[model samples]
Target: MKLTTSKGARALVLVALVATVGACGLPRSGPNKREIFAGSVLKQGDAYVVTVNSRVTRATAVMPAFGFGSSFRNAGVVGSDTINAGDLLALTVFENVKDDPLLGNTGQRVSLLDQVQVDGQGYIFVPYAGKVKAAGQTPDGLRQILTKKLDSQTPDPQITVQRLAGDGQTVSVSGAVTGQGVYPIERPTRTLSTMLAKSGGIAIEPAVAIVRVTRGGQTGKVWLQDLYENPGLDIALRGGDQIVVERDQRAFTALGATGAQSLVPFESQTLSAIEAIAQVGGLATSLADPTGVFVFRNEPAEIANSVLGRKDLRGDQRMVYVLDLTQPTGMFEARDFLIRDGDTVYVTEAPFVQWTKTIGAITGTAGAADSLASVGSSGG
Candidate 1:
């Protein structure tokens, strides 16, 4: 019985072989059996605009609001004189009031006293009070000083001294902005955002905007994104403050069996595996093997060297992780995976798929040739 069964199997195998050969006879010209599959792998030299997320640590702590009358706002005062020698005074005096005899004189009826400018040499020129010192004083302070100086000569003198230059204060604006320059600050306190606007705001590409402040030789870096996301991060600006807006620096490559394989920019420091895949235009349906998708990454050289010396390698080095999208649980790990720059993503094709494609192509070509020959014979 065993011998009979063996013989029967051999006969069946021979018959199957003969049927196959007879059905598809050997052609005069060899068949093009090269498998043609969909999808293209990504290669180097591809350009992509990568978004970079930069975390800028504050070089200096958030400075407390300077109290009123701080040195930063110190200004020279001008005396009650028309000569160019007095403190630089910033005072708002009343002048040009309606003439009234009860107030004082008809032409000088308690007019509004406007603030006047004083030179650095501690001298201010007044119409009637000659030159006076006006450095190191506010508008009110300068007004009192001028009144006393003029009263000694003339009682109830109609005079006023105000600051023409705003405390002689200026602030610098730099970094990623349309216009970066020094702007005269009239107010004592200004917000970081306001200063940025004065300097034409952040640059066009502000994914990694950094606003830096340097005051009294102290420097601080603030994230523009943080300021936008959290309004509390926006700090105040002081006179003589230097602001800098820096761009970000971090990127990644997108490739393999996906539409538009290019470098994708991300402002976020780390990119989820799903996000990276989406940036490359998702996976190709015809050629991507969902279960065989893999991201190849190399460990840092220093770490690799250390591991080599110890003969203990970490999984990240020389390790190929197979991502099985078919399994529901795999989605969690896929989402958690972080893509780094220079990473290579490979989407493999199914085995035996090439064989089917080659067979199909050959069958199609043969059918076309046979139909052409039959038509020729009928025409003859």
Candidate 2:
């Protein structure tokens, strides 16, 4: 009988051989890839250099809660506010004798009841208390003035002043909220966060929300989560304060060899490149090129010039920032560099990744040749 290897046995031997060859050809990163990745950075003249220290210290942000933003003020320690023009006041005046003509002579001792409007002139007309100054006075303050004014003229007058509405009483809660209403801004609801709570906290999660405060035509924004984390960001709101709770649209695209390659949210209003790396799930350990990390952004001409250490920077400048994670100090610099909205963080693939494909092709060809040789032997 002719000697012939069984098909199953031959198949097993071929698989084992391919496995061995595949393991041998698995790629290893060499010095050549590192040089090529870093060499491009060295060759670029227009690129800016943001050292780690600059990244941490150079970034700045304007604070919120109006009035140049006082963190201390936002923590809910505000003094009493005086009423202003266009405010509404409700007055209840009582006298011992209901027979008084000025009081309408109602049977009950509580005679005068009036809802007074504080006009643009900052005055409110009263029956016994004529043109009482309602503006620039607290409810208590106005009560004292009204009682004192009618003290001798009216019989044992008792005055009650309730502030119906403040001049700039309404606060606008818009964007991602359960209810968007023009709420009456009162004493307890004078804070940005307190007002948000009155309108039903937040419809969306604070982690992915931005709280924008606009007052007197000036606007400032803070991360909603940051406001929760740092109470100082939860500012005391002013009259006509517009609070917008928008879903965070600002994201940075993470590409290349990160753990997750996608658009990562800028959870915080201000993000450093180092922080962004964590958000994007860091580098892909097996395939990432440590020396080939990069951030791409457009820079203003002056800023580009200052960062690149050159005076030639001008007009519509864009830059690719190279970061070599292989270096001990490179990571520290990345921590300080501020990441703007729409930035691209790219981590290149190790050169070995490409080499593996090439080696894989050669191995596949070799395997085919051996299979052909086996078939010829079987035929013979």
Candidate 3:
């Protein structure tokens, strides 16, 4: 067929072709295929890529391992079991004073005692003794010592001793708790689990909760679930220790052709690569490359050395890990591989997705020409 078209009609066809090219969702900087950090990984040579087996075996070796409740259990206040410099004491003294009319009415005996704050010198003044050492002594021991010293001052002396306030036997529980205050430990129940229960237990995300115990300027952290599962980790709490229960937002960033591309939080404390992939809505069906799933993380020097199998790394401390989901063993490998906090899961686009889009755009552009051709032929 001999085809001739007016300038206006040709211009309309050209405009329609342009519109079709623009509508098919061509790849761009923000397209699902455009990975967020792929450029940086290419530019920076420090990123190391590892497979499922290497990632699971070597990368896990260097993570910082921490134990909780040591401060609570082995705390000096808990183990010492005695009065300290800051402790408060309440004492009562009874004496038989016959013919003592000034000592309260017709009573032949008199009793007197008062609260005494332990001084910086670790001593408290008694009725007769000028200064008696009270720190480091148990209430019973102090009672005996006071009873002996008052022997000459009061006849048939009876002395009672009680701790008015035990600042050393109390712990502070805060963060993600129903009650944020000080809790006293009076018995042997100084375990962290028990102490947490005494303070109304933990709140926020218990499954992924981080329980941080601070004592004497040193702090240690353990998962709340770890304490529940491991009895040994539920170590006793110590006096003056501080406990903080906070939700672990163990989050990872998802990019590339994944169903969701954003910061995603792991539902639980322990997470495998497969679980993390699924949690981020899985990879996009058409655009995702099953063979190109990658996880980017900042590996410690030790971990990086182990992963690269060298004493020195060629790139930065950052490392890259890839999993080929196309293989039959990929799913199981991912199950064994763990995801760390602040990891980036990138799912690259399949080669065919771009071809399919390009072909679709061509057909769309052709369709516009065909429609215009039909109109021109009918008019002829």
Candidate 3: global Cα-lDDT? 0.73
- Give the candidate order by descending lDDT: 3, 2, 1
lDDT of 3 by residue, 206-254 (tens): 7778889887888888888888888777766666778999887668888
lDDT of 2 by residue, 1-380 (tens): 22354454455666766677667744433223344345354565444434334442363211223222554354453334567677777778777775644565556677546567888778888775688777778888988988888887877778787776654467799999888988766777877888888998889877678788887767788777777777666677665778899987878899878878788887765687778888878888888887777777776776666666678867746666777766778777777777777788877778777777767766785677567657755776
Please, what is the TM-score per model? 0.52, 0.66, 0.77
Sort by TM-score, top down from the best: 3, 2, 1
After superposing candidate 3 on the true structure, give the runs of residues whose Cα lies further than 4 Å from its correct spot. 1-3, 6-25, 28-50, 54-62, 68-81, 85-88, 101-116, 188-191, 235-239, 300-305, 308-318, 359-380
> Quick one: best TM-score, which candidate?
3
Poorest 10 consecutive residues of model 1 by lDDT?
A: 52-61
Model 1, which residues run further than 4 Å from truth? 1-136, 156-167, 172-182, 186-189, 197-209, 214-219, 229-232, 240-247, 267-270, 293-323, 340-380
Provide the lDDT at 134 for model 3.
Answer: 89
Clash pairs, model 3 backbone: 46-315, 46-316, 48-320, 72-236, 72-237, 72-238, 73-236, 190-236, 190-237
Number of the predicted model whose lDDT against the real structure is largest: 3
**lDDT of all predictions, in order shown?**
0.52, 0.70, 0.73
Give residue 199's error in model 1 in angstroms. 5.3
